[model samples]
Target: MITNMRKPTFIVKQSLKIFCLLTGFAVMTWSFSFTKYIRGQFVNLNVLPERLKEYMYFMGRRLNGAYLSSLNKADNHDIPIIFIITPTYYRLVQKAELTRMANTLRLVKQLHWIIVEDFEVINLKTQEFFQSTGVSFTYFAQSKRSETNNHHRGADQRNAALDWIMVNHNPSMPAVIYFADDDNAYSLEIFQQMRYTKKLSMWPVGLSGGRTYETPILKDGKVIKFLAWKAEKRKFPIDMAGFALNANVLWTYKPMRFSTDADPGMLETKLLERCCTWAEIEPLADNCTKILVWHTRTEKPKVRMFDNVLEV
Candidate 1:
């Protein structure tokens, strides 16, 4: 009697185990089918959020337009239009410097000179120099000085020139814009090599005190980093005179003038932060291989005046 009962119990336990396994398999199949069905419905209905669709559409259109425009412009017509901005104050030493720069630019025809003076009126000598050059030039002077700073009103002076460019010329027309100091020496070859600039072109500058050279970090014919004491930590670090920018970039960023409030060594950082990125920077002058410009400063000459005699 006990043996017969044990066999029935064993049969019942085995049947229960089989039922649970079958039920689990059926549940898993149903879950999988439901998931597939939902995915299929989403795909067929194209049920993406409206905002996402709009964003993607806008991006696609913008990219297409940029691509077509770039393709049209890339005809190997390396005729780069260069605009030079020079901020001048108390033009005694700058006369020779300006002459040197003007002479160098004679070889480069597509050049526009924008000279900003830190005064309400342009000096007679500066006026005469520009008149003699017969080059395309514009002169601007700041009306007043509100701050007592070494780089007093420098930001305002630069902004005045930039504003003039935007108003007078097509913002996207020029190929390169350079911020040059009145005292620095520029090489003619610098202008020639800058024609290859897609965005920004940089090279080594010869500074004072036998410091030898200054330039950006190059890796595989590209600037991966900036090798300057001023810009080691910043995304890119080079002197204001070390690089040339595309006019389109200037229009795009539209920096709000240079600031005296900024800490020392912050001018480049602030200006660059607004307009440039590391990838856009192309380093030339590799180990002074293509050094065309030198960071030269003019020394102020002394003049003695005799009584009852006027010095011109």
Candidate 2:
């Protein structure tokens, strides 16, 4: 009887030891995963204080003149410089849209407009437009072909601007980049919102994504979901006009490119998915309350050719 009691007691003690060991192992595994996730985010460029500080210095500068000052700030430079990448193809409407966009952009201070053309040389109108308008701009011509079909557009023109930025800029340059289609309509207030982006920020875009508006659903200052019901089946289902990534993210993730392998309308999604996820995205434009941009495409201008010559 004494031996039997001792055996059962020993067995119970061994089982308890095994359970404690397994529990400790599970806890360690969970802790390691959690630490890795937090470390991954903190390690990214946007989280580094030095990078944001470098760019913030420019926006915090004050200047005289009603046009120079942001409505909210006495100092016009107290915002991130908006680096506008416009990929334009020659068209009669191109001049009109460029002029309109320039007019709107001039109202915003600390902005750089980079216009890249699809052809091997800059368009004459593009050169003339910036000169007369007095907008801060850099003009470049893409060395490769642009769109060969309707399915392919803005890839080459956009890449040229990205390449320029990568070569000329370092990770510390303080700026927010936006791909502004020539036809879009934007509010000056939008630049201010984009300037403060910590990582990647998204807002509502009008007349895009086969819907009236495609926007993020914000919950307690974070993006919980996107509102474009039509794009529910797609990954990162948002319009190109819907989001802007911090230039720091670009400098850090220098390999980002628009690829032919990407499915139609996912150019923005694929490019961004690798950089940040929906949870990392910060929703803007009044916490998803306002529409600061519109995809306002102008009617294609009518052109005529007579006697085997093109007519404008």
Candidate 3:
């Protein structure tokens, strides 16, 4: 019995040896020192089993650390940092949205999250979640605003974010300001598109309304008409995700605030009133040919009214 078991054990040892040899050969072809590479990887050999925690260095560090490390190695010195201002209200899906957004933002280089809460005190849970993202972020708490109803407070929350940026940043800093709501589905290209906004850049927003998309009709590279049929009379009748402004635009227009009493969908229109003119609006995403953004709504989960979810 012992002799029979020896043959199988020997075969297993040979297989591991062959795997190590192949790995070493690949490393050598990549212009790495085979011995040194093996030494470093030896710490992780335990993941294959028959070894213990002392040999699990590869599993010791989180996988994202290696991903972030690679991002740092890329030539990104001049990529303008984007300040994502998200106005979020506390809700059942707030944390879920932020976590999902963080996963998206992690792939974006040189970005910061400025989350403004719609309540008085900073939510500790939200703050901790932001810190855990492994990205730069700032959390602020502001008073709620409601025009017709108490829940119509996103406009006020947005204004507070702008106010925070104005107070913290220099007027001439090289940054692009984007009002990114927590619940929207953003494409990675949105960051790349907004990085070079000289003044205010506008794009077509997908999944808006019940049609294909809402956009600014461009004629010879200028905004002629905002393409919306229902609410034809609003001033700047566009989605909040439809535009981005340069940092200088905010500095030039001091005390930029959203109107609480403005029409339900007039926040974007009213805010841009003091900011960008038609001539200054830069049409992007192939002059509104491609749709790269959507107002993705996450369906709220069903739970008991008095259920203490936090305790779970």
Looking at model 2, report the run of 10 residues with the lowest lDDT sum.
63-72
Cα shift from native, residue 30, model 3 (Å): 72
Superior by TM-score: candidate 1 or candidate 3: 3
**What is the Cα-based lDDT of residue 15 in candidate 1?**
99
lDDT of each: 0.64, 0.70, 0.71
lDDT tens digits, residue span 1-312, model 2: 999899999999999999999999999987886454333332233433643433232222221211110112222455676778888866546667888888998787777788877655565535765777767777777645544333547777787788877876555657788888889989877787888788888889988766788888878887777878456766677877778878887766767777645667767777887788778888889888899999877885432311111112
* Residue 109 in model 1: lDDT: 65
For model 1, how does the per-residue alpha-carbon lDDT over 1-312 read when each residue is reduced to its tens digit?
Answer: 999999999999999999999999999997886454333332322344544433332222211111000112223334767778888865334567788777876567677778877765666556666768766677656644566354534667777777776776666455677888778878887777776577777788777224566667677776766556655555555667787777777667665456556566666667777776777777665533666787787775542211111112
**Best model per lDDT:** 3
Which regions in candidate 2 have their CA more than 4 angstroms from the true location? 1-78, 143-151, 303-312
Q: Which regions of candidate 1 deviate over 4 angstroms? A: 1-78, 143-153, 208-210, 286-288, 306-312
lDDT of residue 35 for candidate 3: 36
What digit string (tens of lDDT, one per residue) describes model 3 on residues 1-312? 999989999999999999999999897775554333344433333333333222232223222211011112123647777888888865667778989899998888888777777666566656666667777777777657534342455777777777777877766657888988888888899789889999889999887866678888899999888886354776666788889988887767875777777766777788888886778889999898888889788996643222222411
Model 3 poorest ten-residue lDDT run: 62-71
lDDT order of candidates, top first: 3, 2, 1
| Model 3 vs. true fold: TM | 0.70
How much is the lDDT of residue 234 in candidate 3?
68
